[model samples]
Target: MPDMFCFQCEQTAGGTGCQGRAGVCGKKANTATLQDELTGALIGLARTAMNSTPTAETHKTVIEGLFTTITNVSFDDEAIECQIAKTEAAKQAMAPQCSSCASKCVRNDNYDMQNLWTDNEDIRSLKSLILFGIRGMAAYAYHALVLGYTDDEVNLFFYKALAAIGEELDADTLLALVMETGNVNLKCMELLDRANTETYGTPEPTKVTMNIEAGPFIVVSGHDLYDLHLLLEQTKGKGINIYTHGEMLPAHAYPALKAYPHLKGNFGTAWQNQQKEFDGLPAPVLFTTNCLMPVKQSYSDRIFTTEVVAYPEMVHIDEDKDFTPVINKALELGGYRELHPMTGINGGDTLTTGFARGTVLSVADKVIDAVKAGAIKHFFLVGGCDGARPGRNYYTDFVKQTPKDTIILTLACGKYRFNDLDLGEIGGLPRIMDMGQCNDAYSAIQVAIALAGAFECGVNELPLTLVLSWYEQKAVCILLSLLALGIKNIYLGPTLPAFVSPNILNVLVEKFGISPISTPEADLKKILG
Candidate 1:
């Protein structure tokens, strides 16, 4: 028997599962168990929600618990245990009689996750899909909730899907729930889309530098734009320059965020490169959400975590949202003495982002004209979470080999693979257009729909291909959303998910025409043909 069981990520051990003392993502067995416990408690809460009316706080707790279990999010056992206790209190408040029932029915109890882990293989696989999908959706929901945006249907679905995890449902029923999870997630993503655009204004095309100006600075990583906005406000005129790291890079495209002169340019490349990039760094790095790697001693003291992204011994910014500690660390480090220039994988000094649906649709006529005139061959959405795994270079090579006439639209950190490359322009629009962060997949879908309308055809009929590289559960929900929309022929890699049993994989392949990526040349030939 193994000490832990975690195979929710693409980089799971042996391409099957992780069951040793630690996972490939550096999560220890004890911490993994605690996360499982927290998830189990959330399940109990979900079961209670089905019976009684749930408060807004109840929905937030469920989202928080699910988001905390995502890969590379929370590694602090204490934080997770605290979350578990909070979940228990919420459940008890909802069903107070269950605590003192003399019947000993064992109902309304925190489920033992081991049951799901040890269930029938096919059954377990289907349930895992629902479990992981909602876990990913929860991150998006948490972001929206923080911004004061949410959908009742989306919140209600969380409880429904979670309760299903604790039930002994048939494969057909569970599978239907899996697709429903995807469908509801689409609504969740849209809610977040509205919250972001309406709150901060629609994003516009903007260029971000890779070079670092000398002086005290702070690097904000993860996906919380509100956290970055607060830091930008608190540090206004404080002489401390701020830079976006990883998924936060898209912040530069927002008119409101871009208005901050001290926001500066991006720092480092992707989440996977943090250990090497932040080593002995003279500045503090504030993590607002996921993709937080295990801190190294060289820069652990300089790391600060806010919201649900926690690691042991790091200074965690409480709900108060006060960034005084992070700001002070930046001042203490004092940054580099001279201009420090940084280039991306392709040796380019600048990266461009903010080509969301509105921006793309604004130029729909030009895109249609180029396609009709044969100047543009096709559109490839090469996006998803980037990770520290081999074979990921496939994305870079895949993008590089694309026909000069075609356009590469990307989002999320995976763009770091070749985003720096000067792919040049076609019809005044760059060959490569970055839509936004992972959640901004909503933007990509909207662009596809508009293009389909322009061509007087279904989205499947458009000359568009989705080549996605996934790493975490957030990728799972996005893939589900794509499936729910009847989007077909998605080519996923560097490897298929371990949580996806052979049986489930077949369902995706047969129904959706989904294929695993082979190589740049081979996939290009197949897609182009």
Candidate 2:
């Protein structure tokens, strides 16, 4: 009668695995169990696909099945059950003879998560890396798939990685697979970047306001741009405004998305504050993906979910993406009677984003010149998911304490900590540049590699530091991508991942120079000095 165990995220209990009736991410025990079943079925399908050629349907099923189990993606037991059945169906299609054969072999049987959870600590750590890393990578893949972009190699690796998870592999073998997960994730992120920029024009620098204009409006949250685009199209001339929330904030920078006048400014702050911020709002909130907290009664009636994101009793918009219900709800709410002024956590009334790789690289000459002239002393990439942990303020403080001569390139929701704060400009560039969403970490890496090439050195030799704050599985895969690229000396906080064993942690520290973040003042001195 014990609870499920999950430690793939940074918010795990006591800096260890979440071992209770529910996950700290608001995932109930039943939902967690169903997620485990879905994952197990996916592993079985992978085991089957390892021998047989996988179809495009098989690849899509593997990507979605893995993405569904990521932290906060699916909360509906029914939805997860559907995923489990689909995975089993895919397995049967690939290995049709296994089920009907008189001689039954368990070679491709589903894996019980408990085995990996209770395995040798080091083995568990390594396997967790492959499992959770892919779980995060799957999100990027899902996003790309929706945009009509697919990579066969990325798809094949999902099967290879999941099959390895179910196998009784040695530590070294699993460890190698763990690194491969990182390598594969880098490619996945790149595929996503290409998909997004091609579908929507490359992101450019644009400033967003925090004020909610008077009128009916719908606030869209999550990482799905396609959902936002569909909503914008459906809501055109309907007198309903659309506001981006959380990861959707970066949509403002996309020329195609910004062309829709109804896509107004962002609303609320980071995902963690939704319960408090959404209370009694005059608008409906549509969630397209993860980072959904347990809904409170105060605003649960106004919450809607689409795609993989779900909550019991909340209205769900199916694949057809007909958002009439959401639009009607927005019209009913009618939003605030007059303009409502809003501010970021730092009390800034405006937010700036769109400093994606295209924008940054376009001004490469200015940046290189600034650095050579000592106008920019250092470059800090301070970004990741923003969680409820008290220590997360370290990001805000870290950005605040960074020298005036330094440039801060931020991405993901973590930038919400101090994004609105005007850090002034260096060489005609804002001191802190918003670099789009978490997957846009691809953009940041591109900038780093470009800079290294400009300086005629490796990325590690460049004057750049990655001070990251992680909350979910996406952050896990991003960290892996960095390590896989041989980028080192990353300052990670507010805490280390609970799934990382002591020996594994030691290996990371010694090999990658990964360090847990300290006080902003101390860490600043260490990095600057």
Candidate 3:
């Protein structure tokens, strides 16, 4: 067998998979093997949980283990191995009698991951959708878990789906579970939405600056708002400033989070540019979650990882979540010499976020009036993950070419493409509205459903067109949610998943009318027409 095989992300090597000494994401072969082993152990734990009673720790460990294997999350073999040991221990505690039995059965053994990889193509495709979709959902679940929120339905589905991956299932059964993954993920996203809004307050439209104040400051990235909130609270009176990066940008929208006087502003662009953006930076960068690129020597010492994100030689904040190392590093770095300024990819000095469902629906009457008055002709939900792919420019161009009478609702890191562009407004609202982070795709769905309700039509009949760019499994789950909701005519790009078999692609196309994005002009013309 090859040393490694990973094609979970959109940029998998040569559009097949990365099977060699290293993955395209810089994950080494040994690290990949350990991840597979960790996955196998997680399967065993979940399999054992089917026949025995498991604790809250079992669900949390399964969520963390699935999330750890996500792209750009962790590349530390030691950490992955540690996670494996923990999974084994969890399994042992759950079914100790099975291990000490005089007659051994294969009921409690870890599922060999390679078996699924080499399974029948259609079965693999359907199961991959379920597996990858849950992997993405676990991220949202993990974030909620940290905020002291738990949903039994969502947690229970984790076992069902993980166990299903290890079973001999047919296409019809697996496909149903695949769509159910989407259905359950919708609830999971809603659960997370409630957790975030209740804890941090509903996000309001907030303008975040791009300038770095002259002093000791730290740039916090990734999707974990709880970590950012804790860091913001701890650094409040210390004279150290805080700036958000990547998916953390939407933290500015939440009332409780933005109230931090020292929570200065945004620092950089999307996650893919971190290596270049953080090269030789004066301040330290703390990652609370995924999208952590390989550490570069230029600023290796400045990277501090917490939660599931880990890398070799980086200072990892443990369960205590004590950020003293990161804080002291910021003190040592002392930040910039003067007021250092930065701009977005579009050279805009400021970025606006927090146009979540609550905020947008607050103006629903005006939006409805605009549509009735023919002032807003169409709506485009252009959002998803951003990456280093060259074809991602299609999103920027597609957004730029949108007609003036249309409205664009975007979320997630993909908005960094054209968010800074002033798309103008209709009925006293900006044409382009950011609806929080990727998890906020729920907000977009809400807005669409509201519009459909206002017009007495189905969501599929609304003027909204979903043009998505996916880079990771989070996008996978979101896509499944949309498909499960029966929304159609969605456009996905820059490239489709390498794990999708030809028959499965045929199924998605025939059932949902899923389209691969072409050129911006061509796609825009087709979508408009």
Candidate 4:
């Protein structure tokens, strides 16, 4: 007998499923059923918000509901149960209990995910775009919240998109909503960009060593700058060193952040590789957000989660935003005995970062001159998160195959695959430019738009092609932003998302000219040709 049943979209446990007595996370089949019900309930809540005026409470519930189902956050049935209750409460608040209706409306009706999974692939993919895009945007919004930043339009779209998914919508209608998801995500990213750069000065070119400093140190991961700042402040003068982990690696380039003396260096590569890297770390680690893999037994106690990122038994620091528990753990571990030299995957001791718009555009004249004089041939934005899947080799090989005359721009964790390579430079600009973290997709978009203006061409017409790798929701939102801007012909993959139905994939391929990446050799031939 099957233990459980779940095929939410194209990509589930496998092409088939992990229908066992329980999920790998130990979730019971009934809970999985309830979670699906909760999702449907949220969709209903979204519909109500769409057709009726919503209170502020409704908005908060919508954001949190979508945020919960993202890859790795809540594994607790109790938590999911609570969220479902909250959704119903919000629904009741929106319209109040209906007074004596002939047809009793089910406020807590559950959505049959199978309906979504079985729908025409194209429509499913469009809805997946709306769903996944909001999930990722919610993460961004949450980060902005820790730093005290929020936007009304960004919140409203979550309701609009979710409501559309539950309603009877056509392919064209859903596709338009998918693009709209991208449009609001752009505003969301802009809010975050302003929150970051304004709080931590514009990132300047800084050389960050991979080395871990001696004595007590703390490792900070995730996308929260406010938490990192708080830790830096708390750990100061405590004989503790702070090191960046995962997406936080780019923090070394920001002036205000880098100015902190105790902020030492980066501890590891990307998020996917954390289990292997954190196995026996001498210092305590803190996760501020997603991209957390299933924790291993060895380092489970040493790890802590803050904000929305929660794992069973891991110490979760709440909204006061206090990080004392993390600081204490770092001191307890006492780091390395002495400074140990470290390098990137390429064996380079120091990785150079901070090529956001300000830095790149500051050298705009030089870049333009280089392109004009034939010194620089093309630009390749090779970025996104790195993954454990075998198909990820395409990114490493694609970067290796690009022409020497091309300048490579990268962001997010995907660069972990090849950031160590010394691709040299065209003129004074390094061949590979690290444009901050994933949220810094704003930087990549800014750079592209600027280059297009400089060359007097549309972003798509410029001699630049985007080869993107997506692992989670953040990447999904960024891809939507690219499409919303009408930039066409993006090369996306290691693998297309399991959630995108074939028909939906076809629409993207037709409208945006999206190509699933093949062998680096073959794809490069097509891109450069």
RMSD over all Cα atoms, model 1: 1.0
Off by over 4 Å in 1: none
Clashing pairs in 4: 3-20, 3-21, 4-20, 11-498, 122-503, 122-504
* Pairs that collide, model 2: none
Q: Estimate, for each residue in 1-529, the C-alpha lDDT of model 3 and write its tens digit.
A: 3499888998899999999899899999999989989888888888898888778998889999999989999999889988998899989988988888999777678988899889988898888898899999999999999999999989989988988999988899999999999999999999999999999999999999999999999999999999999999889899999999999999999999988999989998999998899999999999988999999999998999999899998989999988999999999999998999998888887899999999999999999999999999999999999999888989999999999999999999999998888878897899989998999999999989999999999998988899999999999999999999999999999998989999999999999999999998888889777
Model 4 per-residue lDDT tens digits across residues 147-250: 67878898888877777777679988888888899999999999999888888889898888788777998889887788899888888799998888878888
- Return the TM-score for each candidate structure: 0.99, 0.99, 0.99, 0.92
Q: What does candidate 2's lDDT look like per residue over 411-479, in tens digits? A: 999999999899899979999999999999999999999999999999999999999999889999999
Better of 1 and 4 by TM-score: 1
Give per-residue lDDT, candidate 2, residue 324.
89
Better of 2 and 4 by TM-score: 2
What TM-score does model 4 achieve against the real structure? 0.92
lDDT value for model 3: 0.92
* RMSD after CA superposition, every candidate: 1.0, 0.9, 1.0, 2.7
RMSD of 3: 1.0
Give one digit per residue, the lDDT tens place, for model 1 in 383-475.
998998899999999999999999999999999998899989999999999999999999999999888888899999999999999999999
Clashing pairs in 1: none
